[model samples]
Target: MSGEWLAEVVQTLQGLGLNYAFVLNPGERGAFIRGMGVTLQLCLLTVPCSLLAGVVLAALLTSGRPWLERPARALVEVTRNTPTLVQLYCAFLVVNMLITQRFQLHGQTNPLTPFVWVVVVVSLHKGVFHAEALRAGIEAVPRTTLEAARSLGFSRRQLLLQVELPLALRFALPSLVNNLVDLVKMTAVASAIAVGDVTYESIMIWSQRDNVLELLLLILLWFGLLTWGVSVLGRRLEAHLRMPGYGQ
Candidate 1:
């Protein structure tokens, strides 16, 4: 029975081409594209920004004044403890409401582009995790290595940029890529805020076709393909960046 159901679902999908979907107005393909565009845009923008934030925060945590360090640590703790969905709602919905009510902002309450909002939210959220990951990576780089570089008359900046960060990144890249894949998956939540990502489009299609099962299967396939691709790519990158003697 399950096999039959799966076969039927596959057949239905094969028969449902993009044009057919459009003609039937099933899933609002256009809307789905709009959403996917927003989602991808968010991820692309957020990833780099979040990485920079992570680097800065990690440096602060590892090398700053006690006062600065404690607050950065607290920020990571708070963000990690809270649910991401709640964070999105707070940043997008609740804060928008307050901004409108208190500030009397004239335009759309959530004035930023969906891409920008999602990116900012993702950056701040992922920043905490990445900071911890990076800090661990930085720590893994031996004190002896830094001392050796200094003994060679390398300046503070050179020791960090030339010796430390490059080595740390090799250790950090795998986790960072893993986080990136997770971030891409998390973009689905943006749909709740009307950000029009792939998942949102899938839901729209499901609504129109009344083929919830089929559309959902496609959604699964889409995400699965994306995540698998990311995994493969990460592996290649890790292999490429493997320190000559380190991995051995």
Candidate 2:
């Protein structure tokens, strides 16, 4: 019964003149699925790593020491203002070129491949945005809360760690989720460097099959599902973390 339904669906799609049979073919199916795995790997690695980077940046920005804040602020501003793709290209083409020159490895094309470049570049870019959002959340932390923590002899570090960051994260959850959604979409750019993500795989198949519309539709649906899952998860987390009195 299941096989019959699956066949019918495939037939209906084929009837529309789609070359989606690529999905049914073993070798092509493997490539496309591998592309999806690469995309998923990017999202999984980047989301948490970027969040961690954001926390570090936010701490530096709010630490009240110009020595620390100035440099961190400059980094954040530069990352936020630039295009991620350009950054990816520079890191891959320019920096990777330098690395290759310095270390002449026989069988390697630099330790940093397109995957590493995408992860680092995307994480830093999204991290700056996350930091700015968290800074706002940190500022919105109640003055009374700070005073209470200080009255209890909490050191500045302790206050930030125990009091401010927790509340700030709660405040910034929505923005963080939105950034994550954007970051997932941003992973598509990995294809530009031949990382062979889902987008890249789709391009390969369509270029060969000349079924651009079919592949394009699949790409959109693929990304749409990923972003939708992220959105749902974020909303659920926001609800679970809702403070009793803060919103009220």
Candidate 3:
């Protein structure tokens, strides 16, 4: 849409007591747009990474070896037990501090941006929940299914990959979706680190304009759209991957 037409719509909304401060203000508009870009980037990058991490972590947890299982279990316990904000602080303030100090002697710069920190931290946090959910699903698989796989001479790894994981995924889909939805919300914590996400942008604009109500409404609408999109995508996946005569 053209700027003028958008401005007209903004004017109309203003009459209804919703002042979208960024519509006519170019500077605030630019900052808010940048924030939106970061938010979208977080959603796109973190969700897939978390899923991959979850799969790997779940495999580690069920690998039947103390060496792998112990570390993975510790990771899950630490991540799941802590607040996301604290995790972000530890990742950015603490870990990044050490990285910077370590690299300073070599004249090397820190490799990651605030954006990457948020992505890694959030992915690990949500990944643990996904791992747990999948673990439960794996345990819930019927005895007959395990027997059939064993009867076919399936090795432990082969059985997990070929037979168990597929069914476990179906069983865990709902919980995974819920985790992902929360993952999207967790991306908001990026704002705390000055990543310029939508929430951060909204704060900037509203603080300058003293229009908290207006900005909050828009923020809610924006996040509502994002979370709704995740939900719809999850529902479609559940339907497409649904197993007949199971969980009916």
Candidate 4:
């Protein structure tokens, strides 16, 4: 297509308030959709991994063993304190570079692709928040309840797995949901390391088309729906898991 004609078409689309025309263009649409897919995949993978890591970290922090507890606490502190972008940079540029050099794989891609790096960094970053939230929940469990479980011959593992974790999860549900919502939004940072998530794709699109506002609006709407859905789910879980005669 001629440059003038392309410009006219884009202008017409914008005039009609179809600022999102790029999303409808077959060529551009594919890129946008692919980016959206990557973002979703990152979220799907990060959520579960981060949650599991958070639980483990929280367990270790409360384990009463100085060796395990100190290291876990330090990890949580460092990750939570540092900027996520810096962490991603270090992971991609430093850590991945070392791995690439140490193991020469001709014609084979590195096992830790950009996708894996993003997942690892984002998970650990948010895992700290999850750990903190869960730690509070664990502490919130009534001492009386723990004593009763102990009196009933519950082993430490049994008490934690059956009694403490369940109740703590219920207590922590709201904060956990908030952290998850933030985690979904934080996936946008993956674009920094060239992970090709929605934010990255949008940047590439707007650079050529100059439709920054329109594309950003779409990004905002997409993330809004995602975070809102998470909030709704959290509320439902909170309601369902609420203890009888206890405030939700």
User: Highest TM-score among the candidates is held by which one?
Assistant: 3
Model 2 scores a TM of: 0.93
Best by lDDT: 2
lDDT of 1 by residue, 1-248 (tens): 75566556555866774223442332365676665576667667777888898988887787748987999999999987898788888887776667667655554454565556677787888888888888889889988998899899998668667887788888899898889788778767777776677777767666656766666666677667667777888899899999888869
- Return the clash pairs for model 2, or none: none
Clashes of 4: 0
Question: Which whole-number lDDT from 0 to 100 does residue 211 have in model 2?
Answer: 79
Query: Which residue pairs does candidate 1 place in steric collision?
Result: 27-204, 27-205, 35-196, 35-197
Please give the range of 10 consecutive residues that has the lowest summed lDDT in model 2: 102-111
Write the number of the candidate with greater lDDT, choosing between 1 and 4: 4
Which digits, one per residue and each the tens of the lDDT, describe model 4 over residues 130-243?
Answer: 989989999999999999999999997898789888988988888899999999999999999888889999999999888898889889988998888888988988888888
- Please give, for residues 51-153, the per-residue lDDT of candidate 3 as tens digits: 9899889888988899999999999999999999999998899999999999988999988889899999999999999999998888888989999999999
What local lDDT does model 1 show for residue 183?
73
lDDT computed for candidate 4? 0.89
TM-score, every prediction: 0.82, 0.93, 0.95, 0.91
Name the regions of candidate 3 deviating beyond 4 angstroms.
Answer: none
State model 3's lDDT: 0.90
Ranking by lDDT: 2, 3, 4, 1
In Å, residue 49's CA in model 3 sits off its true spot by 1.0
The deviation in Å at residue 236 for candidate 2 is 1.1
